[model samples]
Every structure is written in C-alpha cells, then in structure tokens.
Target: MTLLAFLLGLALGIGFWLWQRQRLQRQLKQMLGVLQTDASSTAMSVVSRLRQEIAQANEHRSQLEERLQTWRRLLEVAPLGYLQVDEENRLLCCNDQARHLLQIDRWEPRQLRLLLELVRSYELDQLIEQTRHQQKPTIQEWVFHPPCLDGEAMGEVRSLTLRASSWPLPHGHVGVFLENRQPLIELAQSRNQWFSDLAHELRTPLTSIRLVAEALQGRLENPARRWVEQLLHETNRLINLIQNWLELSNLEKNPSKSLTYQSLELRSLIQSAWQTLEPLAQQKQMCLAYVGPDTLWIRADEARLTQVFLNLFDNSIKHSHRQGTIRVEVTAREAQVLDSEGTVDSPPFSNASDQPDSDASPSLIQIDMIDTGSGFADSDLPHVFKRLYRGDPSRQKSQGTSEPFTLVGSSGSGLGLSIIQQIIQAHGGTVQARNHPETGGAWLQIKLPDHKNLS
Candidate 1:
C-alpha cells in the first residue's frame, strides 16, 4: 500500500513539472515576439522621419535657387554696369552691361579668374583695393580705354569716362557699379568749342563796325548827333561784350597762359580799382572803406587782378543804394586750414593751377568785398557765374524801396562775375558769392595765393 501511494505522488509531481515547463516556454516566446515587433516599428519610424526631412531640404534648396535666378535676371537688365569679385579679387559674376563696358569677352558665369587678368585697368584695380582696404563705399572716375573686341590695338579706340562706386561685401568680396559719362563729357566739350569759335569769328566784324560808328560820330547834329553818339555807345558796348567773351574763353582754354605773374601791393590795387570806379560810385553817393593790413603783397597777373576788382566794384556801384558804403576786408590764412573747407567739383572755374601744390606758398590773401545792395537771390546764387546769366531785377533796384540804380552802365554785359572767377582760379585761388552776414548785402569773397604776408 505504501509503494502504490508513492508512485501516485511521483506521477502527479512529474505531470505538474511538465505543465510548468510548457507555460514558461510560451511566455518566453510571447515576450520575444513583442520586442521584435516594437524594434521593427521604431526603425521604420526613424527611416520615414529621415526621408521627410530630406524632401524638405530639397524643397528649400529649390526655393533658394529660384530666388537667386530672379535676382540675377533683374540685375542682368539693369542699365548701369554691375560686377562682383571674390575675396581673391577673382571675377565672380557680372551683368551684360559690365561685360560691354569692361570688354570682358573671355569669361562666362561660374568661372573665376583674377580681375587684373581679365581687364587691364589700373584705375579699376586701385579702386577695388581702396574699397577693400577702407571697407567702405568709395567713388572714383577714370578714363577707360576698352579693349578691341576685333583683336585690334586698344589705343586706336577712343576712351570713355567711367565712374565707379564700390562697396565691400561679406568675406572680402566687393561689388562695383559703373557709369559711362563719355557722352555728357563730349557734349559739354563740343558746346564750349562752338561758342569759342563763334566768339572768335565775331571779333573781326565787330571791330569794323566800331570803326565805322566812330567815323560817323563827328558828322551829325541834335537828335541825329545823339543817335550817332548812341550808335557809337552801343557799338562800343557790343565790342566790349565780344572782348569779354573772348577773354573768358581764352582763360578757360589756358588759364595759366593768360597770366603774367607779378608782385604788387594788394591795398594799392584795391585803391586803384576804387579810383577807376570812383566816378560811378560818386553818382550813387557810395564810399569805399578798406579794413585790413595797410600793406600786403601777392603774386598774380596785374591786368587780370585789376579786372577782378574793377568788375566787383562796378557791380557794387551799379547796385548799391544811395549813401551806401562798400567795405573791403582782408586777412591772411594758412593754405591747410582754408583747404579743410574743401572745394566744389564744378566750381565757377576749373584749372590745373586750382589744385594746391606742396611747393606753393602757405599764405593766401583773402578779400571780402561787401556792399549795401540787394543781395543775390537764393535761386540765382549758383547760376550767377554762368556767362550771360540774367541778373535779378532786385539787383537793379533794392527791395523795399522805389528808387532805381541809375549810376551804372546799361544792365551790364553779365560777363563781369564770370571773368572775376576765371581771374581768381588762374591765380591758383578761389572765389565765392554770398550775402554778408553783418553787412546785409551782396558779398564777394576772393582768395589769392600770396607769396608774402604780414601775418
């Protein structure tokens, strides 16, 4: 009975053991399947996210390219030339206008080569270098001779005046804009030449007419005599105008050639000019008062210097009110200090002498001639020095008054101030017009380089 009981327990125990083993194996298989499914899904999710990101990156790249193409199209059609150079100064990109202006035939887009190798322009190279060095916008103008596209010598072609504005870009790159100003330059030069020729041609005929008018001056009586005198007067006036035009033209053509340098006392010159115009001043009850060092010396052309003050005084006498006082103030200033004020690009006059030289005298004789007359109109100040520019009516009669200026020559030839400017520039100096602050009148300021000064 004991043996039978033991066998029964063993059987039960073995059966339980076998069942437990199967259960454990099924659980292990279930967990392994769950892990495999999770790992596969995670991997697939990561790959899908990567693919979406790649697609977005491609779309962005395409958008950027489209925008770049649009900008290039706009720049291509622009009138002014535009070009870019890399940090190495290698020609990067340029528009059609730039190609033509620079005569760049051997290059195309995406090609990089030294700018010096592509275009032979020292001025252009210098401008690029300056922009890079200063890291600021810079402007320069130079005469550029384009290379012969037909393989002929470049020297055979006419040059163009090119103005370039350069600005630095990121990473040492530079962009430049170019303008072709040759046409404007040519037009101005031609106009000046035509006027100069016409002035020359009229000189001979005018002298003959003056001679005939003078010959008839002695043979008329009463109204006829007055008419003849008037004819002579008008003829003289025309002759004067012609002479002045010729003089101004000559001065412009060769300013230095028109001068004869001489040392003279500045005070004496002003006094002489005042004396010459004293009769005219007397008619208007005007007085000349000079305030400065009594004696000052400068090197200048005597005749031209005399003409400057004569015109200034004549202008004052013509416009000054009754009992007006014309004041002359003189002072000496250093060239460096005065030059700091800068100069105009299109000043009243232009000449090589107008540029200051290191060897030039450090002294400048500044003369301020102020008159108690109607000052220049705000609109006419800039154009006053232009030849034959009409004067303001207020110049003939002061404002807030009814009296007319009757002392002077006929409404003036309009060449007076123009001649004055030429004379000043020819002496390596400057002249300007403005309303005097203290005098409340037309102010003429002139500076002449002085070889010697008191202070």
Candidate 2:
C-alpha cells in the first residue's frame, strides 16, 4: 500500500507542472498580439498626418497663383502702358498698351531679352537705369521717334511725346508707366488755331464799322452824339481786343519766333514805361517808387517788355488806392535762386535792412512789383494768369466808372494777364502773380534768363 501511494503522488505532480507551462505560453502569445496592434495604429496615424500637410501646402500654392493671375489681368487692360524689367535689364513682362507705345512687335513669354534689343529708346533706357540705380521713383518726358520699318519714308518723320513714371522694385527690378501726350497737345493746338481764325475774320468787319462810326461822330448832335460816341468807344475796344488776340495767337504758335533780343538798361526802360503811363497813374493819384541799381541791364525784346510793364502798371494803378504807392524792386540772382523764392519774398511793407543783396548774378534777373491796396481775391489768385479769367467784381474796382482793369467792362475779354504771361514766356522768362505780403496788394514777379551781351 505504501509503494502505490508514492507513485500516484509523482504522477499528479508531473501533470500539474505541464498544466502551468501551457498557461504561461498562452499569456506570452496574447502580449505579442497586443504589441503588434499598437505598432500598426501608430504607423497609420503618422501617414495620415503627412497626407493632410501635403494637401494644405497644395491649396496655398493654388491661392498664390490665383492672386498673381488676377493682378496680371488687371494690368493688361489698364489705359496707361505698364512695363517690367528684371535686374539684368531684361524685359520681364509688359501690357498691350506698352507694346503699342514702344512699337514692340515681337514678344515671347518663354524667352527673356535685354530691353534695348526689343525697343531702341534712349530716354526710356535712361529712365529705367536711373530708377534702378537710385532705388527710387523717377519721371521723364521725351519725344519718341519710332524706327522707320521696311518701306516707310525716312524724310516723313513721325514722332510722339511720351511721359514715363518709373518705380523701383525688389532685387533691382524697375516698373515704368508710359503716357502718350501727343493727342492732348494736338487738341489744344487745334482749339487755339480755330479761335485765332475767328478773331482774324472779325477784324475786317470791325474796322469798317469803326470807319462808319467816326464819320457819323461829327454829324450827330446832343444825346444822339452821345450815343454815337458810346458806339465809337465800344468799336475801338473791340478792335483792340481783336489785335491783342491775334498777337497772342502768333506768340503761342512759336514763343521765340518774334522776339528781337537786345541788351538795354533796365532802369531807363522801366522809366520809359512809367513815363508813358504817367498820365494814367496821375489820374489815379498813384506813384511808382523804383528801387534798384540805376545801371542794371537785361537782354529782352524792348517793345514786348514795354508792353508787359505797361499792362502790369496799368493793372496796379487801377487796383491801388488813391495816393497809394507801387514799389518796384530789382535783384540779380542765379537761376536756382529765382526757382526757389516767390514774388512776395520781402518782409511786410519792407524795411531797408530786409532788402535783397543786389550784387549782380550771371544767369538771371528778378523784378518784383508790389502795389499798396487790397490784394487779389483768394478765388482769383490761381486764375490770374489764365486766359479770359476775370477778377471778382468786388476786387476789380475802377476809378470814376472807367472800369480800367476790365478787359472791355462787365463784358470784358480779360486777356491782359494772359498777354503779359505770353510776352514774358516768349523771352524765356517766368512770371508769378500773388498778393504781396509786404504791400498787401497785387504782386508780380518776373525772372528772365540772361543771354549775355550781343551786338
């Protein structure tokens, strides 16, 4: 019985050990399955994140392309010509208007070439170079002569005026906007010519009427004579207006053509003008106080300059208060100096100490004429030199109902200031009108380029 019990115990022990070993093996297999599932989930997550990032990147690229195309479309249809060039001065892109203005017949999108090779425009090239070098904006206007092509006549020169405004871009690139100004210029010239022709045609009829009126002046009596006298006065005024308009037309056609320049003592010339207008000045009880070097000289057309002075003095006399003074100050300066200062550069009413140093300058002469009265109406200041611009009725006060300042009266032509401007400009000089800060009245300043002495 003892031996049987021992063998049974050993068998049971061996079975128990085998059962434990199988259980451990099953646990190990389950752990490995769990690990593999976790690894696969992590890998799938990584791939999905990468794909989403790629899609976002593509959307951003499309947006950028859309914006670029939109800008290109807008620029293509713009009225002004737009041109772009790269750092190497190569033509990058241009609109149709640009191509037309520059006369560029060939353009290839895939190829880039120097601007000079496509369009031979020195002015355009220079403007681009200047903007690039300065790294800023620049402007230039020039007449462009397109190259004569295959069968065009060389003698029949064709030209157009072009105004270019350039702006610098990143990396030494430049963009230029071109405007063709020839059409506007031609239109203005045509209008001026039409008016000039009308003025010419009216002259003959006006003269005949004037002759008839003068003949009837002696035969009429009392109130009838007075009516004829008024008619004659109006007729004379019309004739004067016609003559002035014709003269202005001629001056505008070619500003320098009629000028006969000669060096004349400025003081004597001004004195002579004052003498001629002395009667008018005395009538208004106004006097001119000339202050400058007695021997100062200038090269100008004596007759035209006299007209300018006469018109200016006449206007001053008409606007000035009774017993008021018109002060004339002369100074010599470099052209640059005149370019900076204005007509009313002096102190209020002036002081001897504040006078400009009159030491002679080589390039220019400045004349300032200031009157003592109410200055220009604020509304009338800018239009003072414009054609047919009239002053406000309040400012155009006259002596004894003569209405001296009016071009012809409430029905005036208002060409006096315009004539003065043309005469000055024709002599290569500039004139500015302003209310004088010193005298508190109308001020006229003139700057003439010196031509030196000539025989």
Candidate 3:
C-alpha cells in the first residue's frame, strides 16, 4: 500500500507539468499571429501613401512642362526683337529676332554690354541715359551702312529707327523690345529732296519775267500802251507765283526758321505797311485808318512779320470798294476769349522784355479790314487760305470797278492768305478770316504771342 501511494503521487506531478506546458505553447502561438497581422497592416498603409504622392508629383511636372514649351514657342516666333538682360545690362537671353537684328550668336551675358561700347553717336548715348535714369522707354534712330548684296557689294547707308521699352522683372531682370523703322525715314528724306528741287525750277521763270518787264518800260508809245500793260501785268503774276513757291519751300525746310529777332514799335510797322498800301487804297477811293495806340511794341523778325501784316492789308484794299474805310485797332484780350475764338492775338512788337503778358495783361493788336464791297460767303471762310481759291469768281472775272484793276485769274494766285498763314505760324502766331458783323465784309485777323514772351 505504501509503494502504490508513491507511484500515484509521481504520476500526478507529471500530469500537472504537461498541462502547464500545453497552455504556454498555445499562448505563444496566439501572440505570434497578432504581431504578424499588425506588421502587414502598417506596411500596406505606407505603400498606398507613397503611390498617391508619386502620381500627384507626375501631374504637376506635366503642367509645368506644357507652360514652359508655350513660352519658348512665343519667344521664337515673335516678330520684333525680344531680349532679357540682368540688372547690369548684360544679356541674359534673346529671341530669334533679337539675335538676327543685333548679330548675336552663342549669346554671352558680356556681349550685349560690349556692343553698346561701340556706339559712337551722341543720340544713342542720350537714349540710353534716358532709359536708365528716367526708367522710361525711349525711341531713337540711327543710320548704318550695312553690308549688301549677299555681303558682296558695299551697302548704302540706311536709317534704322529703334524703339526700346524696358520693364523691371523678377530677379532684377529687364526686358527690351526693338522694332525697325527704316521705311519712314526713307520717305521723309525723299520728300525733302523733292521740295528742294522744285524751288530751283520755279525761280528761273521769275527772273526772266522781271528782266523783260524792266526792259520794256518807257519803250512803249501810246498806241502800244495796252499791250505793254498786259505784258507787265502777266509778268508780275508769274513773279508772284515764283515767290509763293519759294516761300512754301522755305516753310517745308524749317517751319520755325526765321531771322534773328529785332525790337520794334507795333504802330511804326503798321504805319509803314499802311503807307505802302496807301496808293492802292486811294485808287479805290478807300480811307485807310489806324485806330490803335502809337506806343505798342513787339519782338519779331521785322521783315517777315511786316510781310504778314502787309499781305492782309493788301487783300483788304484789293477786295474793298472805292471810298471804303479800312480800320486798324490794337487792344488787349483774355486768354480764354482768344482760345474760344480759335486764334491768338498778335504779339506786341518790341524786344522780348517789352511784350505783353498774355495771361495777366490784356494787350492785343487787331487790324480790321472793313470794306463797303460785297462780303465773302461764310462757307468760303475756312478755305480762304487754300491755293487758287476764288470768291465771287464771276465778279472777279469782270475786273475791278473804278480802279480798272484786274480782279481775277492770275492777279491773286489764291496763295496770298496761305503764305500769310504760314509766316504767322512760323512766328508762333495765328490768323483767322471771318465776315465783319458791322460792315458785313470779309475780315482777316492776326494773333501772336506777346512781345515779352517772344523768345
């Protein structure tokens, strides 16, 4: 019985040990399975996030590439020169047009800055200064002798007008645009040449007529008087035409060119012009009167300004009927009034210091041509300065009344007022034609800057 009890106790101990070992094995298997599942889930999440990021990055790259290509195409195809420069004016990039125009190849940033060093013209230097200092776009032109005929023949000088526009960009970049203007320069040069040639042609005929008229003087008897007079009249008409041609030529050459200014009293000039036209006025039985102050002064080219006033006076006399009164008045006016009238009052005649203040002082000289003859049509006022324009052609064709002067055809070349207008404009003055409200006749007015501001 004691041996049986000891064996049973040993068996029990063995059974308990086996059961504890089994429980530990099962728990180990379950913990290993849970760790494997957690690792797989974490790896899958990482892979999914990386794939999405890669796809988004590819899409962004495609968009950027498309925009870059579009800009490249535009730079290549633009007609005018397109250039990019650094703040130091070194070339950064250039389009095809810029490369062709500037003769640039394998562009280096240093090349453009060096190109400017070769420019000797002062105009180009000024333009560059204006662009840099003013920070504004500027236009300039230069004449260059380019190689011609496929680089075989010597090229004639051709003008190239360049308009450069600069803009500030990111990274201190500057953009410049250039265009060619050779054609316009050529056209202007051609016009000047033509005007020069025409002046010479018209001069010869005038010289001949004046010489012949002087030779025929006092050689005609009473029986030949009419024919001689007609010849003389025609010669004078031709002379007037030639003079007009010369005046037009000068105007085209330099619209503002005039003689050195001189100081003179306005009343004196008007009195002289009036005396010169006195014979013509008297022949028409017209009274030529000056109704202005005697102390008025102006600064001007005496001869040119005299011619302007004289022309208007002569027109008045020629158009006025016999015994008509021609009135001349000088006064002051406001700036607003003259501007509204589309004209400027004639400047006081004197030196630059003696002229009237157009803003503050109301000093203006007005010469009125009032006539008793038939007035001009209002419709014809605007065109009175046009060449060969005639008012009352039928009446003019019938010749003058009482004075027996020829009124139409060649006596007035229709360029008198036109010449007057051009001369007045050159003097920084203005002229206007209107029918008189009181006398119901044609009135010609001249307005100029005050003498004090002549310079």
Candidate 4:
C-alpha cells in the first residue's frame, strides 16, 4: 500500500512541472511579438517626419529663388545705370545701362570682380569711398575718357561727362546711379548762340528809327509834338533794350572779360549808386537810410556792382510810396558753408582799416535792402529774376492801388534784376527775394563770400 501512494504522487508532480514550462514558453513568445510591432511603428514615424522636413526645405528654397529672379528682371529694364558693389568694392551686379556706360564687356552678373579692374575711374572710386565713410548720399560729376581698344592708340577717345549719385547699403554694400548731362549742356549753348546773333542784327535798325523819331519831334506842335516825343521815347527805350541785351550776352559769353575786381568800400559804393538815381528818387520824394559801418571793404568789380546797386535802387524808388523810406543794412560774420565750390564777398569791420584775413576763416557778407512799398506777389516771387518776365496786372500795379511809375526812364526793360543775378552769381554770390516780415515790402538779400578765402 505505501509503494502505491508514492508512485501516484510522483506522477502528479511531473505532470504539474510540464504544464508550467509550456505556460512560460507561451508568455515569452507573446512578449516578443509585441516588442517587434512597437519597433516597426517607431521606425515608420521617424521616416515620415524626415520626408516632411525635406519637402518644407524645398519649398523655402523655391521662394527664395523666385524673389531673386524678380529683382533681376526689374533691374534689367531700368533706364538709369545701376551698379552694386560688395563690402570690398567688388562688382557684384550691374544692369545693361551700367555696362554700356562704363564700357565694360568682359563681365557677367553675379561674377565677383574688382570695380577698378573693369572701369578705370578714380572719381567713381573716391565717390564710393566717401559715401561709405559718411554713410550719406553723395553726388559727384566727372569726365570719363575711354581707353584705346586692343592696346592700340588708333581708336577715338570718347569723353563722357557723367554725374553719379551713391548711397550706402546693407553689409557695407553701395549702390550708384549715373546720368549723362552733356545733351542738356549742348542744347543750352546752342540757344545762347542764337540769341546773341539775333540781338546783334537788331541794333542798327533800332538806332536808325531813334534818329528818325528825333528829327520828327522838332517839326511838330502841341498834340502832334507830344506824339512825336512819345515816339522818340519809345524808340530810345528800344535802343536801350537792344544795347542791354548785347551787354548781357557779352557778359554771359565771357564772365571773366567783364570783371575788373578791386578793393572798394561798401558804403562808398552804395552812396555812388544812390547818386546816379537821386534824380528819380527826388522826383518821387523818396528818402534813403543806411544802417551799417561807415566803411566796409570788399573785393569786387566796381562798375558791375555799381550797376547792381543802381538797378535795385531804381526798382525800390519806382515802387516806394511818395516820401517813403528805403533802408539798407549790411552785416558780416563767420559761417560754416555746406558747399565750398563757389567764392563769396565779405563786409568790412567797423574800423576802416580792419581787413579780414580770408585765409584764416570762411566769412559771408549779408546785405539786406528793404523798402516800404508793395511787396512781391506770391505768384511773381519765383520768376522775379527770370529774363523778360512781366508780372500780371495785379503785380504790375503798386499794391493793387495805383498805376506803375511811368516816368520817361522809370519803365524798366524787365532785364535789370536778371542782369543783377547774373553779375552776382559770377562773383560767387547768391541773391534771394522775399517780402519783408516787418516792413511789408520787397526784401532783397545778397550773400557774398569773402574774396580772400576764395580758392
């Protein structure tokens, strides 16, 4: 009986062990399957993300390329010559106009090359350097002489006067614009020549008519005598106009020929100019008042400056109220000139002998001539100095209240102020016309540089 129970127990134990081993193997196989599935899902997710990233990168690159193409197309059609340089003055891009203007043929856009190697212009290089240093827009004009082709001197050297404007850009880059001004200059020269020729042709006929009118004035009486006198006056006025035209033409043709500069006192010159027009001023009961140093000396052409003052005084006297006053003020001081390409005249100090050393400083002489008369019309102010410009009826009258001064010699040729401006500009001076704030009259201001400081 004991042996039978032991055998049954051993059998049961073996059966139980076999069942546990089978269960363990099944669990291991199930876990391994789950691990394989998770690994496959993670790898697919990574591949999808990489594809999306590549597509986005391609889209961004396409947009950038499109923008670059658009810019290039726009530049191709631009009329003005356009040029771009990198930080080191390397030519990065240029348009057709630029290539033609610079006479460059062996360059392509986007190819990096030194600007100096292609275009041999010192002025252009200097302009670029200046613009970069100042970080401001700069304008410069220079003549370009093309070199001979094929290293031979057989070709004609064409000279082009070019005006260039440059400005700074990002990353130390620069942009330049070019203009050709030779056409306008030539047109102006041709027009001046025609006008000078016409003025010369009219001189003899005008003189002959003046003589005939003078002869008829002695043979007429009363109303007829008055008519002859009027005709004589008109003829004489025409003759004066012709003479003035000729004189102005000569001055414009050769400014240096008309100028004979000398040191003269400002006060004395004013006094002398006023004397020439005293007869007209007295006729209108006008007075002259000067407020300045007793003597201010400046280097100037005495005769031309006297003419300037005389014209100004006459205009003032004609427009002055009867018994009204015209005031002249002169002042001098130092000022920083923004543009130093021109010369100027300066006033003298209080002491007659105290002359300024122009080499030591830049000085300006300001002359303000104000009148108590009808001010310039707003519409007429800009054209006051233009040749042959006559104002409208409202501007022609005195403050819209009375007739213009019609004295025999009072009617001007409408060229006086134009001539004044020309003379002053030739002397390296500037003139401005405005209505005085306090006096409510025409204000003419003249600014001249000190001659000693002129280069």
Give the number of the best model, judged by lDDT: 2
Q: Of models 2 and 3, which has the larger TM-score?
A: 2
**Candidate 2: residue 248 Cα off by (Å):** 1.0
User: Where in model 3 is the C-alpha error above 4 Å?
Assistant: 1-196, 209-229, 334-369, 395-411
Give each model a TM-score: 0.69, 0.78, 0.49, 0.72
- RMSD of candidate 2 to the truth, in angstroms, is 5.8
Sorted on lDDT, best first, the list reads 2, 1, 4, 3
Which candidate has the highest TM-score of all? 2
| Candidate 4: pairs in clash | 344-449, 345-448, 345-449
Query: What tens digits encode model 3's per-residue C-alpha lDDT throughout 1-455?
Result: 79999999989999999999999999999999999999999999999999999999999999999999899789889888877765565666777887666555555544556334332345434444456666656565655333343644345434466555555565555566767666666686687567557757766876787677667767877757667777778778777776665675576568766455777687789889888888877887888666555476667778887887677677677766767877765554555657544455443222334434534544344544455445565556666776556665544322344221222222377667777777777766667777666766666667766666656
- What tens-digit string does per-residue lDDT give for candidate 2 at 1-455? 78998999988999898889999899989998999999999999999999999999999999999999999999899999999999999999999999988888777765699899999999999899989988889989999988877565866756889999999999999999999998988898898889889999999999999999999999989898999899999998888878888888889878988788887888899889889888988987888898766576678899999988888887777767788888887765554554333332333343434433534544676688888767676667768777777776666533332332333212256788888889888987788888776656778888777777544
Q: Is candidate 3 or 4 superior in TM-score?
A: 4
RMSD for each model, in Å, please?
7.4, 5.8, 12.4, 6.0
Candidate 2 structure, TM-score to reference: 0.78
What residue runs in model 2 are displaced by over 4 Å at the alpha carbon?
1-50, 87-89, 106-141, 149-152, 334-361, 394-412, 453-455
The CA lDDT of each predicted structure is: 0.79, 0.80, 0.64, 0.78
lDDT of 4 by residue, 32-110 (tens): 9999999999999999999999999999999999999998888878877889898999998888888888888878877
Better of 2 and 4 by TM-score: 2
Better of 1 and 2 by lDDT: 2
Q: How many steric clashes between backbone atoms does each model show?
A: 0, 1, 19, 3
Candidates in descending TM-score order:
2, 4, 1, 3
Candidate 4 wrong stretches, greater than 4 Å: 1-67, 102-161, 222-230, 283-285, 320-324, 333-364, 393-411, 452-455
Write the residue-wise lDDT of candidate 1 on 34-92 in tens digits.
99999999999999999999999999999999999999998899999999998889999
